[model samples]
Target: MIWLVIILLLLSILLYLLLVPIIVVIDTINNTYYLELKGLAKASVIEDNIEVLKIKMRILFFKFYMYPLKKMAIKKSKKTKVLKPKNERFINSKNLKRVLRVIKSFNIKKFYMNLDTGDYAANAKLYPVFSFLNFYKATNCNVNFVGENNVQLIIQNRPVRIIKSFINL
Candidate 1:
């Protein structure tokens, strides 16, 4: 009877240890799924907002260039350059301010903008204030760019050092 009771106690301890890890894994999966769902929802909203902005741009351009004054001016002289209004030229400025306000209100921990080589031409179009804010916020930062199987970090215009001290050189 003594041996049987000891064996049963050992089995209970083994089962508890095994079940604890299973519970932890399930909780981790639940949290990951929740975060993924939230990311998808945010992406969808951003996509919709971009489509709306495109529509607004189209309407503004048509109203500015297709108006009666524009037609009369074109008939009068073909040399006049029909330029966009100052406010229309600065539409992106307002949008950038709105984005910065949202970022500040939410207290974003990190911000990233992925631009291709061709995008250099549009750097002039970005708001100077937004660029300044980004630079100010980037102080004491760790930025990593992972491409394919290569990982690199840029720290203050220098590459981060990777050390393996355990191995002899």
Candidate 2:
């Protein structure tokens, strides 16, 4: 009788272990909270900690597991921006083009900027430099600011996944 009980316990434990990975996937996909500050800021594709992924199914929901997230929140920000620094000149299309060209040359994968007010963040993506520059000129004046006295540029590129090759098609 005791041997049968031990075998049953072992089988239950194995079943639990097999189900854990499924639970984690469901939790991340279903329970994720996207706090969007559209006019202020927004976040997309936030990365989770690898350790949380390794956590036991029971303790994964604990507060300690959720700590250490890299988040820029408005209420927590204290650093004040010195309204327009001296060296930072107004961005013009010609000058902005030069800077973007340099950035493209270096092959910068990610660029991030947050407002001093701490309520906004600009996530800009640039790809294929020559075409982008041409598009900018076509939509805006060649002499002064690109659009509306402020150079408003938008670049759309597909999100890259590093592990796509490893996954079977």
Question: Pairs clashing in candidate 1?
Answer: none
| Poorest lDDT segment (10 consecutive residues) of candidate 1 | 154-163
Estimate, for each residue in 49-126, the C-alpha lDDT of model 2 and write its tens digit.
553322211233332223334354658558876785578568977666665543343222222221122222211222
Reference-based lDDT, each prediction: 0.31, 0.34
Per-candidate clash tally: 0, 0
Model 1 Cα lDDT, one tens digit per residue, 69-115: 22233356658788866755545876666655433332223234432
Best by TM-score: 2
Q: How do the predictions measure up, each by TM-score?
A: 0.19, 0.21
- The ten-residue window of minimal lDDT in model 2 covers 20-29
